[model samples]
Target: MSATEDPAAETADDFPAAPPLPWRLDGSARLGVFTLAQPMEAPSTVTAVAARRLLVFANSYRGGDVSYDALGVATLARHRHRVAVVPRHLWVDDPSIRRAGREQASTPSDPGSFAWSDSSARIASGQASVELSWHVRTRLALPMPMTFTYFVWDDGRLGCIPIPGRATGSPITMRINHWPDHFPELAAYESSLALRLNFAMTVRPQRLIDSK
Candidate 1:
């Protein structure tokens, strides 16, 4: 689906009623697999300097091995790009949302809403450091917390990092599911990199913006 599509078009009634509150996966079951549909293209406007200001937040499910765990969702919002992978994490956190069988607590006391805040600072090297606290609703009725820190440098590089809370469960699962329709290209990349590994994504824009 296009990112501009109305989310309301896919309502709860469209799918079977959520199976249950807290879905559970068998400890020994084999996780599923996914492949990226395409490569992600950097926005034309993203410069080396602006790239440093970019931030990304992602959440993955632990099934068997950390390297092969399936990525549940990932989100990035910059001056040029606003993307959500498996946006359910941005709007809802029920186990039934993705059929992963795991549930998180809720936040804002709303079943399908979230709250967030951002802060920035100037470092000694004259670069800017930014941080974002993104909370998602979960079965615990509490926020499943994910923090992201971004460091931008004069040379034009951005560092994106994710720090998940303690309650976050794990051992990465091999298969990833529920790829967000808004970012089919990114989904394809994630699917191809099924193995668990920590790496930074760098984007160099040829143009500052796409008029299209």
Candidate 2:
């Protein structure tokens, strides 16, 4: 009944929740930018079983409706990371998730692309600790936009990239969410621009880990 309450707004008495639990790096790949243009790479493939779920994929270009990230999943089954709420548009009918045409299935001809965005994920808690928040909105500017955020730690590794400052056709409203109970009261926010960014998140020491 909490986790920011939105498992499709839960109904029918609500009872269905599972995803998260895969540590030591089972899935993770990220990239983000603020004002130099060219840094939107993404991947956090899957970590379902209860380490508080996680799944991400990005390739969006909000300004003209050009999306190519056919794979974006999020689930934080437990272990804190609470305070959820970020749903504007995120659908494909679940069906155990397997719709290749945009992005998620690494190869097999790679053809995944869908435009328009607005996404959410939330969970918050305290007394010891727990937090999770995610946001993505799109219209590309002139009315809407999109970006991502992830913050899950207590040892699972994550929390650093926070870029917000742009100018390439300004008109922004970015808010990348983070977990640990939606810390500092909904982290990251901006309306205009002020420009000041420098980012890095490295963990490629030797990657090739995937558990199908």
C-alpha lDDT values of all predictions: 0.25, 0.25
TM-score of predicted structure 1: 0.24
TM-score of each: 0.24, 0.19
- Report the lDDT of model 1 for residue 41: 39
Weakest 10 consecutive residues, lDDT, candidate 2?
20-29
lDDT of 2 by residue, 9-67 (tens): 33333432212211111111121221211222222332323222233223232222121
lDDT value, candidate 2, whole model: 0.25
Measured by TM-score, the strongest candidate is: 1
Q: Clash number for every model? A: 26, 36
Where does model 2 exceed 4 Å of error? 1-49, 56-58, 61-68, 74-113, 117-212
What lDDT tens digits, residue by residue, belong to model 1 across residues 24-111? Answer: 2212111123333443334233323222121123323333221112212222334334221211223233324422111111111112
